[model samples]
Target: MNVSQSADTVWNNPVGRLLTLLVGGGLVAGVLTIYPQLLPVVRWVVPVSLVFWGASRLYRYGVADSLSLAAGCLLMLGGFTYASYLLISMGELAGTVAQLVPVVGIFVEMFAAHYRNQG
Candidate 1:
């Protein structure tokens, strides 16, 4: 039943959505200021954060929500692969994953929250 959530409320998720907006705003602004060429990609940054956010969401959230997270992860992986192809080598994929330290940490924390709630 999606618990207490409503259709309009999905986008307004408190923790992840809010943080994604704040950080994503800054990221988009910086992209616009520094590299106008990347303006198009600015839309991508927030959604990726949302992906990690949703991944961390309670399983009660919904099966579709979980699917969204998987799709988001796949999108991110594809994006990384494409970028690597253009300007990075396969060897550098390892380094790129390393650069995802903060992301991994956030995801881990979210999972911790998920498990803690379960127990």
Candidate 2:
């Protein structure tokens, strides 16, 4: 199968999706543990991932379906930037929460979409 088909298969399959998440989480954890000093550089992974994901969606479905994705990515980038600032100026907890807000928002969006489709 082609790349698109492979990606769809993984995304559509519950086990594959879970495994993908697990692997990604593990990789991130490992990287952080192995090279703590790279933390600053690692933070950029989110926005870069967002950009690539948005670009892929735009490529596959065109601009009509990607405007929101582009906007969301931009908002996320801004949020991340602010979160980094919070980390430097505020306490660790505040900075951590700021960083996690976007992640939680994404999960909430995913669940909303899933339930909306089911109903």
* Each model's lDDT: 0.54, 0.63
Worst 10 residues of 1 by lDDT: 54-63
* Alpha-carbon deviation at 46 in model 1, angstroms: 14
- Candidate 2 ranges with C-alpha deviation above 4 Å: 44-77, 80-84, 87-119
> Candidate 2 at residue 80, lDDT?
63
Q: Looking at candidate 1, what is the lDDT of residue 99? A: 48
lDDT of 2 at 83: 49
Residues 1-119, candidate 2, lDDT per residue (tens digit)?
Answer: 99999999999999999999999989989989999999877766665565454445445545453344444454455456554753568677776666666665455445544654675
In model 1, where do residues sit more than 4 Å from their true spots?
Answer: 1-91
Candidate 1 structure quality by residue, lDDT tens digits, 1-119? 57457534755778757776888888868879998888656545544554455444434343455443444454445445444443545466675663454355446546644755775
Native-referenced Cα lDDT, model 1: 0.54
